[model samples]
Target: MDAQVSINDSQAVLRLGSRFDFKAHREFRDAVESLLGQAGSRNLQVDLAEVTYLDSSALGMLLMLRDKAKATNKDVALVGVKGSVKQVLDIANFSKLFSIA
Candidate 1:
């Protein structure tokens, strides 16, 4: 798993690659935390276009991220989800808890 983070005053984007599982925990958490730490960064867009797979742990990670984001007054959006990644999120009904694009 790989994560690339980009942030600005208006928005923050985290681009994920390949598998998104527990292996991504530390990097994902760091990226999100860095973005949330920035002043005026109220929106976080998680780019899933390059992600091909995800496990239940990934869902838990997302939920944790959401909780942290909420605590920091930030909103999270998952973007470019497709194939198995999309299916898993759909099955988990994450759209109800996040903004999926």
Candidate 2:
């Protein structure tokens, strides 16, 4: 899995690659960590449109991001999730825990 993190002012966007799993741990965590360093209300968006798969480890990573974001007062959002990836998250009841768009 690969991740690209971009920050604009207080908004940070992390674009995921084809797969989101244990391989993405470092990149994903670093991207979320970037948001924690910013001040004020931060918009941390995880773009999963390009992601074709999401393993259990990926779900765990998302949960970790949520906790870290919450601690720093940053807003966490999952965007562009569709197909199988969306199904996995839905089955996990992550929709209730996160704002999916």
Candidate 3:
């Protein structure tokens, strides 16, 4: 599973192509944190359309991103969510904490 990230306009988009599990947690967090650090823009977006699997660690990462964005006075948005990823977010009531598009 590979996690790729890109930036466009004011948004930092993360495309996850693998199961977001504990094994990838460290790399995922490091990559995201590095990008967030480099992102001078004010908006962040996590593209979960291709994420076939997700777990609590994924949710924790999202929360961490939200917290980091909030601390930086920026906005974080979750986009392109579907299937199990969407279900997890919905079941966890994360839509209330994040702006989903």
* lDDT of every model, 2 decimals: 0.90, 0.87, 0.81
The root-mean-square deviation over C-alpha atoms between each candidate and the true structure, in angstroms, is: 0.9, 1.3, 1.3
RMSD of 2: 1.3
For each candidate in turn, the TM-score is: 0.95, 0.91, 0.90
Model 1 poorest 10 in a row by lDDT: 32-41
lDDT (Cα, tens digit) per residue for candidate 3, span 2-89: 8778877777777777688788788778777866776566787877777789999889988988888788878889888888788889
Positional deviation of 72 in candidate 1, in angstroms?
A: 1.0
Which lDDT value does model 2 have at 62? 93
Please give the ranking of all candidate structures by lDDT, highest first, separated by commas.
Answer: 1, 2, 3
> Which residue pairs of candidate 2 clash?
none
The segments of candidate 3 whose C-alpha lies over 4 angstroms from its true place after superposition are none
Relative to the true structure, candidate 1 reaches a TM of 0.95
State which candidate has the highest lDDT: 1
lDDT of 1 by residue, 1-101 (tens): 88888987779988999999988899988887787787878898899999998999999999998999899888999999988899999999999999997
What clash pairs does model 1 have? none
* Model 1 whole-model lDDT (C-alpha atoms): 0.90
Model 1 alpha-carbon drift over 4 Å, by segment: none
Error of 1 at 20 (Å): 0.4
lDDT of 2 by residue, 1-101 (tens): 77887788778888988988888788888777766776754788889999998899999999998998888778799999899999999999999999998
